[model samples]
Target chain A: MTLHRIRGGPRLSVDNDRCERFGTCEWEAPGLFELGRDGRLRYRRRVSDEDAERAAAAARCCPMQAIVVRGVPG
Target chain B: MSDGDRIVIAGAGVAGLRAAERLRELGFDGELVLIGDEPRRPYHRPSVSKQLITGAARPVDMTLKSYTELDARWRLGTRATHLDTTQHVVHLPGGEELWYDGLVVATGVVPRHLPGSPRHDPRVRVLRTAEDAAAVRRALAASNKAAVVIGGGLIGCEFAASMRQMGRDVTLVGHARAPLYRFGPRIAASVTELHRQHRAGLAMNTAVRHWISTKETFGLHLTNNQLVVASCVVLAIGSVPAVDWLRGSGLTLDDGVLCEPTLFATGAEDVVVAGDVARWPNLRFDDEPRRVEHWLNAVESGRAAAENLLAGRGQARPFTPLPRAWSSLYEVRLQTIGLPALAEDTVRLADGVTGFVRAGELVGACGWDRPKAMLYWTAELDRRLPAPATTPAPARWSGPEARPAVGTAP
Candidate 1:
């Protein structure tokens, strides 16, 4: 339920406990999320408005349903 | 097309739900309807075997958030009985026919049952739906005897891991020499070793010879002359696509609904297929049409099918996706890209990395506890296989045009 806000864009968060590190989000939104070489998940706290659709697609495509992106206009 | 056109999506699983969402996201503001046999809304199915079994995640937690914003009619608990492609109608069990300008087939798959299994027996269970997981949990909690899980695929292995975490004595039985045999024998051995370290019994390369159920205990006699006794038996044997209703619908049906490269049903422009029920030539690896039953494939194909449906044949792009899947066994995480099952040889690249080769070419790669390696290999595969050529324009279909010619035979 922790929400991380971007400076002037949408907020985003990922529930680490539920995330299996599938790297699917990384595939959908490469600029926002990355699975590091050490087998860890690294993601930005927020994304710009232009990338909001990609972030939403990543959240929707996450197999674990762990990612949450808020303030993205439909 | 006008906003008054109707689009009916059969099957409300992840694929069907994704298609519906993509249709809306792509600005297809029209009449939308989703029909599914499951009584509940689409939920995350992968959790049923792991988190749901362990009570770590509830049914509500698995609900897809995208479903809330869908402005569509949902016909849950309703089975699609027949399809008349000529008249563009989907027949329901109660003689209700739904006509649509476009149709999406995403009925998904059903778990295959073990032959001669006692249907009325409470000890026997199969984990596919939420109810199945709950039943299995209840059965495990009610018994002190060891639990026998038949089949060593991803679902069975995951269930075994969850049961072990719950402090249950579990035995995993598989006909292959090791668990996850499709991922190559090395990764399978590592998984087998992980199970061994957890003190779970491994029954590999064996088939059940006899089913012995008495008043108190359930037992499985192996072909190797060993008896595995347990209070509960879970059959995790694979699944078959739920395409029974599409048999006489004039759509080519092999193991699944055969589709062209664009995911449109062969010889049909207005109908498209997606999810576990779609068999198409990936074109990323080969032209052989195959069905991929994975979580990512469902999400990817569902969106692709939806986009192609709107693009029509003239503007549609070929649907070519590299198949990917993953499984968790205890502390080990196995991830794979491309078709490992089609590999003729396997080469161990690193301590936890294995590369699959077919005809001296890398067809797939897998990583055990090495997510970074999987990502690297995924990029390599993407570079090796270029994106398929743009779909050629077939006959157009809209107002008065005849149905488009089927692109290519699957």
Candidate 2:
């Protein structure tokens, strides 16, 4: 698993092979996920403690369930 | 298990894919064969209209799951030509025959094109498939003229909204006064207002008589003898079950392949149907069988059908599916549940949202960007009703104030 680590926050892992870029994560956490010009999903590897809820929502709501957030800060 | 215990699934759409996954999850280790006429793997249909059309999602991004993730024999681009229910054989073109102990028909629906419609016209497109969506995207990018969309259903309104957002002058034509006639007046009026707010020209209560395609442009003539020229045209009228391949198969076909509550085909013992092609009585809704073409219905029915197929007919329980669907308008996401078709009365909620009532009960509800209300009502409506008992005249609904406050404020 390729972990995209965020500075001073939780680490994120997106199964690129499994992600279909449906952008549900973008709706859940706009700060974390943004669609690229080529219609692919761009996201932060990690997020601050304040954005943990949104990050969790994104991971939960993904139809493909491809987003994985780990090690959230207190 | 014996060689005859192999399971075959037709149509590699959402329903078929879900069934395959479910069978695997249930530890069905038999040989599984999935057949599809489309060259590509199963892709998400909902995003094809919203994200794909708006350039937020690519064709690759629409996949419900990767092809490698599905553990089955995939026969993509191969159409099932015939079925020999007596011999438990499926006939494919080029004389290929597949015999299965259990068969799942998830053949979904195909867009219903108008009579005398020209498929070869470069400027004409239908918004059913990913390829069709991509074609429209390309056409939209290359053209500078107005775009005319026929049939103001969900797809029509969605495309109109997206096209207008893309800065294309859009004119939406529908036979009804509103886009979604089943939602009743209040919700339809809100949708109408949304379209109007986006500056889409409404050609309601009209039909497209004919299409005139020239070398440079396309022209549409309406029922009122009004001619509108456009750079391209999209047809979003409706869809029909893709059941022609089962003609000589001896399977029961009314509007769709008739099935029992367990998703088992009425005429065949080992055959089951799911997705848009299956018309079975939903126990939750009166006993009358209905066909649902929504994405969530496909997933739920597919999983349920797989479970029943594994359990066998005598032990199988009836599949009761909850009706739910969502749509993205110009700026709001409309989530709805229950039988909007059963709606005889309407109640307008706050912020232009609406709910439909039948026999003095809230049979359906829809909201604009109202997730909490949509989710609560969706779950609430999934519970069994009181068997349609006759009651006195239903009081005029004054909106959300009448109902007791519980889960979320609408």
Candidate of highest lDDT: 1
How far in Å is the alpha carbon of B141 misplaced in model 1? 2.4
lDDT for each residue of candidate 1 in B17-43, tens digit (9 for 90 to 100): 999987776656567899989888889
Per-candidate TM-score against the hidden true structure? 0.92, 0.80
Error of 1 at A31 (Å): 2.6
- Candidate 1, superposed: residue stretches over 4 Å from native: A1-7, B1-4, B391-410
What is residue B257's positional error in candidate 2, in angstroms?
Answer: 0.8
Model 2 compared with the native: what TM-score?
0.80
Clash pairs (backbone) in predicted model 1: none
User: What residue pairs clash in candidate 2, if any at all?
Assistant: none
How well is each residue in B242-333 modelled by candidate 2, as lDDT tens digits? 99999978799899999998899998888889899999988777788889887777877887788778767765667776666777777676
The 0-to-1 C-alpha lDDT of every candidate, in the order given, reads: 0.84, 0.76
- How much is the lDDT of residue B85 in candidate 1? 90
Which window of ten consecutive residues has the lowest lDDT sum in model 1 chain B? B401-410
- Could you tell me how far off, in angstroms, the CA of residue B124 lies in candidate 1 after the best superposition? 1.2
